[model samples]
Target: MPDHVWWKRGVIYEIYARSFQDSNGDGVGDLAGIRQRLDYLAWLGVEAIWISPIYPSPMADFGYDISDYCAIDPLFGSLDDFDVLLEDAHRRGLKVVLDYVPNHTSDRHPWFAESRSSRDNPRRDWYIWKDPAPGGGPPNNWISNFGGSAWQFDEATGQYYYHAFLREQPDLNWRNPDVRAAMHEALRFWLRRGVDGFRVDVMWHLAKSAAFLDDPVNPAYAEGAPDNQRILQVNSTDQPEVHAFVHGIRSVIDEFEDRVLIGEIYLPVERLVAYYGDNLGGAHLPFNFQLIHATWSAPALGRLIEEYEAAIPEGGWPNWVLGNHDQSRIASRVGAAQARVAAMLLLTLRGTPTIYYGDEIGMTDVPVSGEDIRDPWSLNEPGIGVGRDPQRTPMQWSARPFAGFSRGRPWLPLGRDFQTANVETLREDPQSILNLYRNLCALRTEWKALRVGAMKMHRAEGDLLIFERAVDDERLLVCLNLGAEARQAELPAGLGRWRALLSTVSARNAGNNVEFEDTVQLHPDEGLVAVLTA
Candidate 1:
């Protein structure tokens, strides 16, 4: 295994805290439950775990509307429980990365409460507040990410405060030096507690335009979807000033040794790479989210890979994520069979790969009805297929009642196929997606070519996406079939043979030698990682 930068060479598993495991029968997962599952994660061979927010929150936007930065939410556990989770994770050789939300705070937060108390309050500048326009409405045309105007009218103060999402969550005025200092201290408090690192949430929103300018209209905006799509968000996000704030954040995290700082930025490829900073001092990896939102086509994905790789700074590392709490699961997006093929593409790519929890066992999104929906984004816009509760359902750990996630009724419904699609059931099946993930993880540790190799060539041929990763004379080729029908593919060299390291279809064994003069046959939704001499 590579030791210099474990984050760059190792696979990361993202866990949604509320749905991971429920220990105290509360139906909601907590710190203690996560501790009990540490062994399972370590056994799965992930180097690190990026847990969603566990800080004190109002649950308005779930854990994202944090009321306290340094304290653990009672629903999750106490601070002591968090310390134990961290200690146990490190003891098992696994790193723990917390989700850091520096962009906004719950309206119930003391800072926001104090800032909104009165227009003359000392902390009034702590949050963005503006007098109503002459026409008696929002200060600007900015729209809330969750729908409605971004500015909320404060009755007592007679001023409107900005909120990027729900009115219950107010955006912090990061331009204030005090706000910066306080947020930095919040980071230090965790670093002192021995947390490995942080996955900074909305890292690009740390700064906004000083002028409070109205965002230009989005010409591509379509009706009946993405309520905020009417605006392009030119002046509201990815501001030039954000890089400097990111530098300060980088400096603070650099104080601690061997700690990783990851940023969550959702911008185009050209602008996304800017988060790496002028000299690569920004985010260690500013999350390439293209894969999550891109079309699942070999030709489309092939061009995406080349463009993203080309846009990355020379020294900046890259990372890939297939699914997360915010989106639909991979299995549901591209059928169960294709998800296996996706695993090979994600793991073999020339960058760090993050496997969303439950995806390892081919978990699909559980249907969430309107009354059962928990996501604010979905509730704000009904019937738009934007509900996230389907993907945030409880993990299927076993065949036990409620998938063994909780003794009490679960907070959300479990997948209908949890009886067959579970860790315990699939752990014994060599052909299962769970075992496929295990083998791919082991493969990464075994081959340096897949870890730190240069991506020499990548191309799309018909329904197949082919790529090569090479280190010195060691070379590994990854070929994936994106369609449901079998296809014949030609090798670039016209004549070559390689030993199959692993196959998504479970057709090839370790010693199986696949040879071809020019063309090779691939089964439906098949992908393979094969080793050969350079």
Candidate 2:
């Protein structure tokens, strides 16, 4: 693999800034804290670190509502601290990817403040503002993803401003050339600071319908589903114009050699591939969340992989994700035992894989009660259970007070099992999840087949999932059992012998001396990668 384009062949580890570590004893993680832990990340064998949004904000939506794109939040650290973190990360051979939120900005952002001040203000067009409908309500029936109407009335101006999320976050009018140029400049700002790339937040929401038409009701929406899902969002999101806007952003990223543009798009595989804009003008990797939403069954997962592999554009690369800041932890979604299987599946896939922070140690979601809830979505819709606070809790570094994540109380409570389920304890246990992840990553680096290979589904029967990954002369057979009982997979004719390279049960080389004649047996929830020795 060439070192020039690292993202295509490397695994990405996501670090939620406020929950990673705290250096100032302020209960919130900071850039300085992240900088201090560079050695640990380097040892983890990840090629890059993708930090969640750290821009200056009012803490609305936990920094997604950016007030200043160029400045680092005092809550995270000063700009100088960020520079040091970037320098240190580069020195350790770990590329840094910052979260870029271009869809909306904090209502307090200077541009929004000026735009909302009056109808005739020069910056009024910077944000999506419009006149009320004839009946004196919001301009349209679009609903915010958080809850309630998408439009928030400004008493002073008597017009409503559109927001796809919380009212405090006003969507930018990407149709306006000024807004486009300003956002592009924001990209240049970080590139000038020596950052490697950006993970664009809500890239699909960057453009909306010019007609401001009412979104049609979703026929399949359940009665108790999220209010935003009640509508089909035809006009509000995934518009054709979004592709052009993404191309512009990609152009700006191209100005900086080797820097990547990773768009956060949650569309179907067909539509998702469109973000890889016409060869060279789209996101280098549009995050693929199929595994996150797929059923845990072996057949379901196998079909998803096949569909995703087939959908990629000729030259566009593929990516996979199992967990992230906004979703439930993999350990929670599947059982703790299955999470090991998940780790194996994620790392050995054909394209790049992104590992969520704390997943290496099998971190489960921390319970957050009503009073403890900090997510705007949970607060806005009290009974819906849509809050992301549980998954955004502080990382478990040790058994010490606050899990050694901070000297002070963590911003969010630590998980109940943190004492035993932490990096410190897991690092010492060779059979631990952390060690499994480290071994898998090291193997991926050492083997060309696992790093950059062609994947083909070999079998998907009952609870067993089997596949082959190959590069040039090397071929690997991966078998996984998603069931609670032992399962056997029959090898094809002419596939002579095999040696266990890695297993979820830490049974490496358990069957090294045994030459296969027909079938292989897998223990319950066991997964293994083996080399064909014929």
Question: Best by lDDT, which number?
Answer: 2
Clashes of 1: 0
What are the per-residue Cα lDDT tens digits for candidate 2 across 401-432? 99999999888989999999999999999889
Listed per model in order, the count of residue pairs whose N, CA or C atoms clash below 3 Å is 0, 1
- Runs in model 2 with CA error above 4 Å? 1-4, 507-517
Score candidate 2 by TM-score against the native: 0.98
How displaced is residue 184 in candidate 2, in Å?
Answer: 0.6
Q: What is the C-alpha RMSD of each candidate to the true structure, in Å?
A: 1.5, 1.4
TM-scores of the candidates in the order shown: 0.98, 0.98
As for candidate 2, its clashing pairs are 277-282
> Taking the tens digit of each residue's C-alpha lDDT, what string does model 1 give over 173-219?
88899999999999999999998789999888888889989999988
